[model samples]
Target: MTAGETVRGLLELTRPINVIAASVLTFIGAFVAGGVTTEPFAVAAAVAATGVAVGAGNAINDYFDREIDRINQPERAIPRGAVSPRGALGFSLVLFAGAVVLALTLPVAAIAIAAINLIALVAYTEFFKGLPGLGNALVAYLVGSTFLFGAAAVGNMGPAVMLFVLAAIATLTREIIKDVEDITGDREEGLNTLPIAIGERRALQLAAGLLVVAVIASPVPYVLEYFGSVYLVVVVPADAIMLYAAIESFEDPTAGQSHLKYGMFLASLAFIVGRLAVTVPNAL
Candidate 1:
């Protein structure tokens, strides 16, 4: 394949939506950390590094699970022969290294957070993927790290830290729900996900509880005066939708429709709103 083809393949494999989510979360965290100056280069570098790390994670996930993916996700790039497994592994390693280099130019805290992210991704890909619940926790940790990295970049670890902790809990809960969504396929592939190991009903109950915690925890910073009330108004509906979806999942774990996915999409909108609420003038 030509360079352009390889690049396109990599982009497709990495999934832009995840990159965008990471970028948005990072921006929110950076904005919340109020002491920071607007450093465009620093923001760009951090976002780029995050994108690289996410891409690397995707590529490595595909490489490590090529066998199971061949069975469950035949349309994926690796399974479809668009990119060889070995090539994907090489691409992942290169992107991971690049992320580290980009991170080094930022504050030491940022570099430290980025390094932890890299290590978590590697550990997840290598050891946690097959272990029930552990994979989801690792993924949740890294997911929250995007925002933490932003906080670190700006030298404000106070409010940003709180936001990411909530984010971690939320993402971990959602990850479990996602596993429930994929239980059949995962079981077929002999993967031991939470839903498969813990039984679907109990898993859904756990997911519902987690979603409740996520929604309730999200508004704490705003209530405590770390942010404005505008954020609450904007994000309340999104959080409600998430809670409702979790309730629905708990009510009917056997119903595998597109509603949960849509709920997740709407939930993501809350993050964007949180960012806008904090960044906009007079929002408080």
Candidate 2:
């Protein structure tokens, strides 16, 4: 493949929106850690490095789960022949190496956190991804780590840890909803997703309950006096909207459309609220 083709294939494999989300979380973590020396370039390199790791993990997922993607996501790059398995694997390997190199240039704490993230990503693709609730939990942990990684990059770990926990809870809830969305494809492939193993109604109930918890917990940081009213004003409505979307998704789990919609909505809300919360303390 030519350079442009390879770059395009890598971007397709990573899904740019998700890459942006990962970068945003890293920036949020950094901001919450009190390291935003400049608004534009604040931890930009760290965010880009995290993006590489995130993209690499996504590409590796495509490589290992090509068969599953063929069935569940035929339009994906691998199944659609936009990228071959070998090509995707090569892209993934290079990105993974780049992530490590980027981490090495960051602080000691950032490097350590990035190393852990890289290991977790590999483990997820290699082993944990198929292991029932454990897979969901592991994914949540890694998602939560981005926030701490942001804080670690700037040498401030306190508030970032708190945000990390909140993000983990929200992510786990969303992951359950995702499994419900893909239950049919998973069942067809004999892959044991949460919905298939636990039953759809129960799984929906669990996801809904977790989402409610996360939404309610969304404003606790502000209520606890860790942040000013800016977070309360911004995040309260954001969580309410997310709660509605989660309910809708729980009600209809038949298609990827609803799941994707709800998942994107929930993620957007969380991101907005989390970033705003990080700023509220600073504004005050």
Among these predicted structures, which one has the highest TM-score? 1
* Residues 26-93, model 2: lDDT tens digits: 88788767787743353876898889999998989889888878887898888877788998999899
Off by over 4 Å in 1: 1-7, 250-284
Residue pairs in candidate 2 whose N, alpha carbon or C atoms collide under 3 angstroms: none
Candidate 2: deviation at residue 243, Å?
A: 1.3
Q: Candidate 2: deviation at residue 28, Å?
A: 0.7
lDDT (10s digit) by residue, model 1, range 1-284: 56676667677677777777787677666766753357666777887888888888888888887877776678888877778878888888998999888899889999999888888877785789768899988888888878788777877767777777777777777778777877777887778988889898788788778778777787787776666566677667767666766777665543422354455456445555555565675553
Candidate 1, residue 25: the lDDT equals 70
TM-score of each: 0.88, 0.87
**Worst ten in a row by lDDT for model 2:** 256-265
RMSD, model 1, all Cα superposed? 2.8
